[model samples]
Target: MKRVPLYAAALGFIVFAGFPFYWMFITAFKQNRDLYVGAFDTRHVPWIFNDPPTLEHVRLLFGQTDFLRWVANTLLVIVAVVIITVALAVPAGYSLARLVGRWGGRLGMGIFFTYLIPPTLLFIPFSRVIALLGLQNSLGALILVYPTITVPFCTWLVMGFVRSVPWDIEEQAMIDGYSRLAVIIRIAPRLILPGILTVVVFTFTLVMQEFVYALTFISSVDRMTVSLGVPIALVRGDVYHWGSLMAAALFTSIPLAILYNLFIDRFIQGFTMGAVKG
Candidate 1:
């Protein structure tokens, strides 16, 4: 009986958090009439389907746009960025935690501060760099720039995560004649797996959702990522393709949502522990 309020609260929270996805799901399939009805029209229920659902929006999104190409571009960028962030952040973090001695914490904080600088502010400078490299209108631009955003914070996260790991195990390995590089390569990684995963997931999400750099650097339709592509494709002048917009959002977001759910435990641990420990 005492648990009833807790269950109700949990249910309420779920519904509240999930309402937008619910709206997107229905709006994606809803008929034009069902969707455009005035809010004052109480005769039609807004929450439930007012008419039979259709796949027209889905077809429009898949058939009429470069959505698949955007997906591929987004995935490629994600893969490259994740690899770069991990390769850079993990080592950088471990170095700060173990190698930098007493100043590591201060250095890690300074690095994390760089991550806090808004992407909006950095995109202008990045645009110049991309132009210099001749990567304008290219996926390569995104692959290059995203690491700048991801690496700093992820480094701090990994540094904190590494700090939380017990030093004794790593010390024992070193005492057994394993070199520092060998300890990092062989043993430290296993203990810091959660932090690395956190960096991977964070980098993936950042690359997927980012728009400023993608839009600034990529002008060609085929080169745009989903975040930049969808609105440009769907919104023509003042007319909004709400159904297709919703469909595109629903499609792109579900996989990310699923990924987060799958790793929610580790994600929370990595984020919170990293912040607190640091």
Candidate 2:
């Protein structure tokens, strides 16, 4: 009998969390007449298929728009940004955690505070930098600009994670004649895998969702990321394509959802261990 409440609570939470995806799925496949007409008809059911589902929106998204290109661009940016974030954040974090001694925590916090500065404040200055570099309207602008937002915070995150790792393993490795650089390259990474995965996931999601810098720097249709491209392509001057918009969202979000599911355990471990220590 006690399990009933627990199951009920679990069910409720699932419904609450899963509702948006459910809504997106239904809306994406819903016919325009069914979707619009049902809104006016109070007796009509909104959640179920009052009319037969259609692939019209999906067709429009793929057939008419540069959605595939946007996906490719998004993937490209994600890969580059994740690589940059991991490469820079891991080393900076390790240095702050191990090499800098007592002041490392303060330094790490200082770096983290830079990440707290709102993107709204940074975009203007970044725009000038992008222009000066002549990267406007290009994927290179996004690649160049995204790291500024990701690196500082990720450095702090990695530093915290590194603190949680016991120094015993690395110390033993060093005593066994493993050079500092070799231990860092070979042994430290294995201990910090969870944190690296966390950074990768964080960077990937950030680049996928970021719109401000994308909008500020990229004006060309062909170069737009999915977040920027979908709305720009679908919403024609306040005339919203709800079905297509939902379709785009559904397509874009599924991969992210899957990624979270896959890395959820390690992701949680990374944050929790980091929080407890550094």
Name model 1 segments beyond 4 Å from true: 1-16, 262-278
TM-score of 2: 0.88
Stretches of candidate 2 off by over 4 Å are 1-17, 236-238, 261-278
lDDT (10s digit) by residue, model 2, range 225-248: 999998886676878888888999
Q: Where does the lowest 10-residue lDDT sum fall in candidate 1?
A: 269-278
How large is the C-alpha RMSD of every model relative to the true structure? 2.6, 2.7
lDDT of 1 by residue, 1-278 (tens): 57999999999999999999999999999999889999999988989987999999899888987888889889998999999899999999999999989999899888878877988998888888889999989999888888988998788778877877889999999999999989989999899997888889988888888988887888988888999998876676789889999899999999898888876765565456454433
Candidate 2, residue 117: lDDT: 90
lDDT of 1 at 2: 72
TM-score of 1: 0.88
